[model samples]
Target: MDIAAIKEQLPIREVLQHYNLYPDKQNRLRCPFHDDSTPSLQVYYKTQTAYCFSSNCATHGKSMDVIDFIMYLEKCSKHEAIEKAKTLIGGDNQLQRLTRQAVLTKMFSYFKNAVYNSKPAQEYLQARCIDYRQTEVGYNAGQFHHGTRKDEALIKSCIEHGLLNDVGNKSRTGDTAYNVFGKWCIVFALKDSSNHVSGLYFRSTLNNQDQRHFYLKDRSGLYPKYPATDTKKLILTESIIDAATLLQIPAIASQYSVLALYGTNGFTQEHQAAIQSLTQLEEIIFWLNADQPGAEATSKHAIALQSLYTKARISCVKMPQGEDINSMAQAHDNMDVFIDLLEQRTADFSFSIEKENNNAGEQQEKAKLFIERGAPKQPTKTPPPITTGELDSTNPYKLRYERDTVNYYIQGGLPKTTDNMKIMLVIEDKASTQKARNRIDLYEDKQVEKLCKEAGEKLSLPAATLQADLYRLTDLLEQLIEKQLQQARPPEQALPVLTAKEREALQQFASKPKLIKRLNELLGKAGIVGEERNRIFLLIIAISHKTADTLHALIQG
Candidate 1:
């Protein structure tokens, strides 16, 4: 096939319209390619392409590519896609070659005559609350006779405008038959910016059973007419009624040119290009329905305009809840408030860091709980308590006990138990409680001094404090375990190396009580309360020795 001929025969505008590839200035349509929470997919008439820049999906392509993309989305073949495209375009592929000018001329003559002569068509427009006089067309009730007695002046005008052609025969019901029939239509000339007729729109009477009323016929390659000055702003709405309603708004009329899409689904690349071609527009306001689809389409169209002209300001004119522009205009005599609503529009894009943080925090909490419930079991054992007089200066038990008590108190634990232990030492021995307390205090103060010096080199003040407390607790516990090993004297002959389980139990008896108590006190200071603190402490105890060792290695590292 000749590519040039195919391109010429295939109207790009019509193809885009067929695939619903019009810029949704209102951001209303869900992107067909992916599950998008917002409409970021932009369709443009100037470039004849659609693209999505939002993070949701990467869809960008020409009109034909859009169809192919839709096919992929539907999981269908190209042939099937074309068939669907044909249905959407509202015509078969063969009809594309037919001269639209010829069709318009023939159809208009028939419709103009019917509108002037038929009582039913007149009543239909009136019943729908449409004022036919504003269209500047003549209407005569006597021109619709079935035979030769038909009004000659109406017939002559119809023929001259190329709005009628003689069919072979009259209907048996006695109505005059014609090659083109517009029994229920209101025909009008659609002009361009140059005030020349470019197309004809045949709108059917309101009472017709078929809701499909409007038909467009291009006059050669002429552009659609818009009633805006080169430098003025323009407001685009979805329907003719909406356009008229908006025009009646004094503020909108004073500041902008208004036009309608004619229907919700009437958007086409030709229409988009025509609007964009207006070089004088500083901004374009999309006055669309305030529903989901309308909002989505508005955003898409806004993106398209932004892509074309970096400086172009796009805004949306939102309608009141459950009310369209036409209805709202009829209800209120003033348009100032409506225009104010448009001026106050805001950009519709945002990111939520708080939401992300909440999600991550919830996941961490869940994992912690799961580990607590699924931890492996361990055994426990008891050790001999140290006597007052036997607690010699070089005895490891005495040194370890004093060190552990001081470590616990410095790490935010209560000093009650450690004070009691010191008092018991003084009463049972000749040593003074104050002297023993001062000794333990001096030892803890020296350890803290060393920790603070190390932490100061590595962290900020708050972080350093936290590090010092953790380090002090760990060092005291390790010293206590060493003391337990010396005092236990497991058989003295070293008969056999202790099993991993026995070794772990011995280590626990040496260090577990003090560590658990310190951890519980730290939890309380951190605002953990009641059953929660108890649960967390129990969970720590239930952890396997191997797991605890791994955790300790991590913390120390």
Candidate 2:
């Protein structure tokens, strides 16, 4: 069989229809050569060619290639494949015919009218919080009737420049408008490789109301549309509004191309394929919602496309807490903050195993003991002992006493004798003070023992001599305690009542600035005018007027 004759006799459409190998509304086909899960192979009726689009196995070729593929699948030679192709064509010439541009023009017009007049498409936009009129181009009722809405100014300008039909629209919905038969619909236009209007979408504006209402259109992948001359970068957002929001940023104003994904959940294989086909695309930034699902989808799509375009860098732009891009734009006129955030953005899912391992190693080292085992233990240092005078003079203790006494005096006061007794008991039994005193005594005992042992070992002296020194130190401690107690005792049998002279002197000391100045001068001369001495003197003055006996007892204490 002559190969050229066989090609002319092949019924492409009939074979496709017989095997259910027809392209969907988008002119896409499943790989007949392989068990493809999706329609990874596409047939362009206009070009009369087929191509495999799977990333794993992109085996694209012509009609002859298709015959060759069938031959291979059926385990037959080229002659057998030709015979099978003849049988599949069934002598149908209509199968080989392609639809003309006039049909596309008619389809676009029908859908555009359906979308503008359809209540369902209007409601869908409303439900999604999108206002068609608020977009860059105003809506045209007549254009809707014609199945295309071009920017009037853009069309007029292009027409003047002899560039007619240069403007077009890409529907958010996929290709289904070609089948819309008197259904409520929303429509958008499709553009060719030169960005000329090629198709239209007509979708149901009403949702969840009826099963028969559905329509969409796409003219994207076939277009060789170059971004505006000023566009050097591209920003991919989840919505058209979000894409507009990017243009609002001065940094990105004319420097980038902005495209909308329509929604987070609506990303399909066609969308991915469209994005992957952009040869001029250098970098793609996924500016999605700052939400869990949005982030997840962004990551998934970013990863999927990264393989298709190696230079593509993916980063997520998070909006302010609880605010979306629309709300943020309303709150702030400038996009400085948002742009800054984008510039500083990083891939949230990308991480380094080596860094994590280093962190773990550092933590393990931190957990190890600092000191080596079996080293001689260093002696614990003891704090300096507090003498009875210092204890009685301290501001903390004096303040405590004053506070209690003031409260007591206001409350008709505790008896003087009872107060003194309570003070003594507290000094002896309070846990902190008792602990401190015990530690001091234990340290002293250890020192004495150490001294005696050292003397016995070094001077060959009797341990009894060191024991005598320890005994003398103990006697001195006892004497100090006795003296403190003796001084604390009252002089009178029943504490002497305040005399008139004493009362006058106390009042004068408290009220006269001259007297206070003189007292301070005398205290300075005596080298006792510092904080500790002042506190001691103040305590003495505050409690001294109770009785001569109390004053003497306090001095001793």
Candidate 3:
């Protein structure tokens, strides 16, 4: 609101302090835009702007107002700087509001006409990667109703609307009206959701000027000035120029609607209301500048959208660091960069509050399911306590535990079990490291007992301990052998044998190349392979045929 008034009234010192920047007794501070060794920025209270004398600084020898300083410090757009300026200026209505639609239209038309006349302004827009012809943008030469019969009335109205200023003297056209936007500025028509022009946004063509961004007194409205009622997807950008930049890309403009925020803190009540009205909205993606403030804003707005529109998919497209859409578009002449980055949007927990909530809900649901189903059984039983000996080639398996009679073994670094079909018994001297290993066959109990006795005598261990160990080993071997036999030869039922004629018919059916190819394809889809797959194919064909006699099949391993 009243951007000119704010710049005049708001002191540069106050703006500095708001950002926690303090100037010494000399009213100087280190330049924040670049690496500075000392305070090179000098504050001029008379002009209410700060200038850095450091040649290495980006703002070297340039006077920056409250808005410009904010833009540089926040690494945001000019529109964002204006929004930040509003906060520093305290309240809205610093000047009278421009409510006359007729006058606003005339003003917009004048600026729109100026774009065609000025080649430099056109080049500036083109350099910024903005399509002024397609998108509703203009060049403000700061000439409002020059040399017209209605000059006095127009000047008075423009002054009241903060579009013109009274220089306290009559001009060549006999009016005290001085255009506030000045010469060489790009004009953008900021429109409401209903496609009505609500305000005007100005960006200076002069790079040397610090206060390059300016908005109409009442900075309220979205860019593009169109109905978003049918838009299923929406793109939110940080600046109007960035939104305009997206509008130039046919791919983006055709499918998604772009809404520009003034700054990181620029999401207004009007923006919220406009978005809420989009009943058909399926997704909302932020294409803000790739800076710290932009990142923070993207997350903040994404969370807000999640809370407000739970069904809408909220996400953000990360640009190159410190680059915005317009700058990136300008760098790369093609739209593929935008499309590629759009495909890689981050809308998960970082951006979406609903995603976080859903994750928590999913975890709770999993816990509930576990309770209802009963806790899952452990894949293996708890292992026995073991004191393992050093690995050796002779005894590959480690000792699990040393009982009074014998030592148990852990086979293959895992818990000893009957499934592995490997077991060992170690008989060792209680006083020394000497030990004896006895390997026995599961079927030969007496032979294993004889070997155990001989090994025990070699180690000088008690005969009774060796005998007890032999008994224990025999029982374990018996169970393991039984388990192996059961696994290797599972129970089977008797099958009827097919007649010679039926078998001949099945063999004939399985010989077709087309059928075999189709069968292989199906088997491939089911992840079946090798010789077993061929057997299954034959089996399928055998079962599909109408056979009067029962079928007997033999498969090779």
The number of the candidate with the highest lDDT is 3
RMSD of 3: 28.7
Residue 424's lDDT in candidate 3: 32
Q: In TM-score terms, which candidate is top? A: 3
Candidate 2, 194-265: lDDT as tens digits: 444443333344454665222223334221122443434567777545555565565775566766665676
Query: Which is better, 1 or 2, measured by lDDT?
Result: 1
lDDT of all predictions, in order shown?
0.48, 0.46, 0.67
What is the per-residue lDDT of model 3 for residues 1-557, given as tens digits with 9 covering 90 to 100? 66787686565655665565755435577888899889999876556788999999988767888888999999999999888787655444223333455346556756775777899898998878777777676787765556432344445667777677766777776745464644578888777655556788888898855787888886767776643688798998899888888887888788888888888898888889888888999888888988899977876777677779988877788665556787666544346767778876765432211222364465222111011123454576654444333222222223244565445442222112443322334455656767665434434556656866687678776666666655565564555446546777867987889999999987886786687566667666787766666656576668766777646666677
In model 2, where do residues sit more than 4 Å from their true spots?
1-192, 198-232, 244-253, 265-281, 321-341, 347-557
Quote the positional error of residue 206 for candidate 2 in Å.
7.4
**Model 3 misplaced regions, further than 4 Å:** 1-99, 148-150, 172-179, 350-557
Candidate 1, RMSD to the unseen true structure: 35.1
lDDT of residue 50 for candidate 3: 88
Q: How much is the lDDT of residue 327 in candidate 2?
A: 42
Pairs clashing within candidate 2: 120-205, 120-206, 121-205, 176-216, 185-203, 186-203, 187-201, 193-223, 193-224, 488-553
Candidate 2 similarity to native, TM-score: 0.31
> How would the candidate models be sorted by lDDT, starting from the highest?
3, 1, 2
Q: TM-score for all predictions?
A: 0.36, 0.31, 0.45
Model 3 CA lDDT for position 475: 61
TM-score of 1: 0.36
